[model samples]
Target: MTLSNDTLSELPADVARPGYDRAALTPGIVHIGCGNFHRAHQAVYLDDLFNLGEGHDWALMGAGVRPGDAKMRDAVLAQDGLYSVIELDPAAKSARVIGSMVGFAEVASGNAPLIAAMSQPSVRIVSLTVTEGGYYIDPKTGTFSPTHPDIQADAANPDHPETAFGAIIAALKARRASGVPPFTVMCCDNVPHNGHVTRDAVCGLAELSDPELSAWIKTNVAFPNSMVDRITPATGPRERALAQSFGIEDAAPVTCEPFRQWVMEDNFPAGRPALEKVGVTFTDAVDRFETMKIRILNGGHAIIAYAAGLRDIEYAHEAMADDQIRAYLDKIETTEILPIVPPVPDTDLNDYKQLILSRFSNPEVADTIRRLCHDGSNRQPKFIITSISDCLAQGRDCTGLILESALWCRYCYGTSETGAEIAPNDPNWDRLVAQSKLAKERPAAWLEMSEIYGDLAENAEVVAKFTALLNDVWARGSHSVIADYLTG
Candidate 1:
């Protein structure tokens, strides 16, 4: 008999579902943003801990920052708070049941339940996967954007706040008043020194409301920086079909690449589950890992995605499969980019490069160029800025990175090579498009916006290189430009 949806209740007798008495599991952690990356990364780790008979007292309570998250709430609830995760690799495929999350804290309705959950004495960790933009930070300045309407609303009402920063501060105040220990604020976003950024945003918002409370937060809260990696694509019909095939009635099952890594600073104040037993690397400095991953992997992603998108390549693997584009990526990383990266213990950059290539070439994942290309304004600063800075410092040729930036600027123009109308993805898409057009007319126009490129735009040599490459890209298109750079 084929595995049926009804058979899911009892884990097929043969397959042990990591038995943990549900009655003993209580919600001890509150997570914001119940997205795919969270499901495939942190939740998976927590599930592993629970399966190992550890973290039995800890369960996840999902919370959303936006009303659009209501759909995810409904989906997780339909599956008995259970979800399927498929890990795909070129060599193998593995599937697992993740049951770390127990309930949802509806944030759109009101902050009352969410605040209460955070205010729980038993809740020791308040984790986040609120993407880069959710930080409400100024992309140019790298500071909390208080003028943002969300931040403004949060600043206006210090006590009952809506933004994540507000919620955290309000919850912290409740803990302070009630004589409860504060939960460690763990940030799982991809930003550099995420803990520090989280600290700045939270305390920045808090300072606006009450200076004393902000000072208290600085003294008490522990923001641990983390480096999390898992290539999980957005769910589509194929993913839905995969879940259905497994006889699982999952409304929002997540499909991810087999590879995963999470490195964090070991600094939880109240208490934390011994997650190290389940493959979490707790270290003093996550800077090396963060820099290595962001510069090579993420930086390469930006380089290839924009270049490929300009050539009308649909998916990432498809772009990687193209010999010309693949060679171009290899040349850029090895020659211009890799030398600047500080060495990590036991990490062979060459081997890692090979692994990245294989992962990108995996046809099954179908990671889209457009998905990777979204939010260039926020992403480029982290992914590309450092490499560009390194090159400028050493007086090395940044011909390739400059070309990559030009491609990104061209991509923001919102029209594809085949004249297809590209939809806007970034919060600043309109601004990016208007500036890019003006820049194309006067090659340094966009870069001159000191806020984005800083002084890099005014440097005659850098502007000349970028302008030349931008002109070449417009003349011969993406592949040819890449081929020319690789050979000459």
Candidate 2:
């Protein structure tokens, strides 16, 4: 049966659906970027909370700002804001429909309705899962880009805004004027200091035209930092067919490994759902956890993705199956990456490393290398380059990271070494291709992207190794570069 409220009872008896009355639920949270990850992670947590019959007022209202998000809105709304989450493990697989989301905004009509709904007194939390690049953050400065066209448009006309953060600004403005308590802005992206960055983007953009309003926001609003992890792959025909096998004709089903982790700062002045009740770690020190996860797991994914993609590897597990790739992942984390990571409370670094590598090696998850290699322009700065920066600052060797960067440069050239035509994926795809092609002969040319590399291009030691590796990659191929590095 097609997955919807009407067909809920028709679903297989084994597959779990919401036991609580959907009509009894009310909206208290609005989530931007209603993607598969959000469904498999945050929405699942809330589904568990709802099943426990505690968070009846905290039902989620899914939202989006981009035009492409309209499709997501259509899919979820058709299912009555209910979707199936398929957890894949090698030994066993399970399918269940999660019903944490009670409603989704009319995305085609724009942000007025979204902002108006968010401004209601019933809504107390506005969260985001927009990717690292969606925030309009400057990679070089680590501050919100004041010149971002969407931000400028929002600043010029605050009421009729375009971006998600802009819509948030408008909602906050309305709530402040009406004496409704402001919603806590929670960022769930993989960016470092994600809460602070979200705050900076919203408040910095707010300050441009309304200094007093921005000051009010700075004093009153709470943007909680969070670390979220799950390997939810893009929904395709295979996932849909799997859903059909389970007697669920879900239009948009999410498939992931049976592993999820969320560590968050406990800073919700406006009240939040009891996510910690469902295995979410609430910590006073978010930086420690975020640093550990971002550097090791997120950074490690970037390392694997770029290195693997250059050799035309398809799935992440296939990449991890390679001996040299696994060795490179281990060596880079132990030496270059983990050295700069701070001590996370109750987390054994080595054990965590094993857990991450095992997750990467899960064949059932079927995470695509293309997905990981998609946004190198934004991700390289946050997930990869930041660790390299710390390694250089702490007087550690970043040779492996430099190779990863060179691999990124090579990957961006729009062709695998196998001569496979790489489709354009990144927003800065043109510049990456042009620079990468230039860097083939002039190996230093890739680092000249000051926006992406910042001063790392100018670091004599790092630059020398980066140049040498790029030259090696162009001459020796990615496999030979990894082999030589391991042998050396």
Give the number of the best model, judged by lDDT. 2
Candidate 1 residue-wise lDDT at 438:
91
Q: Alpha carbon lDDT of residue 165, candidate 1?
A: 79
- Residue-by-residue lDDT tens digits, candidate 2, 1-488: 88888999989987989989988999999999999999999999999999998899999999988889889989989999889999999998899999999988878444998998899899999999998788888777877899988788888988778888888888999998888999999999988899999999999999988899899999999999998988899999999988888999888999999999999999999999988889999988789988888888888898899888878899999999999999999999988888788898988998999999999999998899999998888888878888888987888888899899999999988888889989997999998999988998888888988888898777888778988999988888999998887876
Model 2 misplaced regions, further than 4 Å:
108-110
Q: Write the per-residue lDDT of candidate 1 for residues 1-488, one digit (tens) a residue.
A: 12223445555333324456555789888999889999999998988899888887778999876778778988787665777887766676555677788889875644777888899998999999899877877866777777888877888887667777788899999999999989999999998899999999999898887899999999999999989898899999888787666555566878899889999999987888888998999987698888888988898898889888887899999999888888888988888788888887668887877788887888878899989999888888789877997998987877888889988888888888778878996878999999889977887886776656767886888888888888777778876788889987
Clashing pairs in 1: none
- Model 1 weakest 10-residue run by lDDT: 1-10
What's the C-alpha lDDT at position 376 in model 1? 85
Candidate 1 regions off by >4 Å?
1-7, 10-16
**Per-residue error at 125 for model 1, in Å?**
0.4
